[model samples]
Target: MRFILVNGMALRPRILCMLCCEPIGAHYLKEFSTGLSFCGHDCYALYCGRWISRAEQVKCPAVAETSC
Candidate 1:
């Protein structure tokens, strides 16, 4: 099992599912600018969706009222 460091803390590549928070395998984790660790595809998708929405909101304040 591979490990990664985030915020100066060592974290394993695998993580609990965002929905269930159950320990899963690291194979599902995707590489990102922040770090590498995601429970599964669904969780990753949800995370990415949220990030996109947030980024869009930041880029276009008319779309949504939120700070990046």
Candidate 2:
């Protein structure tokens, strides 16, 4: 949830999906630990897939010189 300050009043803005940038409904998928919201399973899966790829790349970076 995000807040907007207007006239000394704080208003909560609509929650949007991090993946699709769409407004989330009552039934939405979210990661409890990271608070990552997704509109549906497809978006969540895509997010996870991307994250895994990034993690793998970071864990095993390319080596300029490989000795056998």
Best model number under lDDT: 2
Residue pair clashes in candidate 1: none
User: How well does model 2 score by local distance difference test?
Assistant: 0.59
- lDDT of prediction 1: 0.54
Residues 15-60, model 2: lDDT tens digits = 7878998887655676655777676677777777776677666775
Q: Count residue pairs with overlapping backbones in model 1.
A: 0
Query: Candidate 1: deviation at residue 18, Å?
Result: 6.0
Q: Rate the local accuracy (lDDT) of all candidates.
A: 0.54, 0.59
TM-score, predicted candidate 1 vs. hidden true structure: 0.48
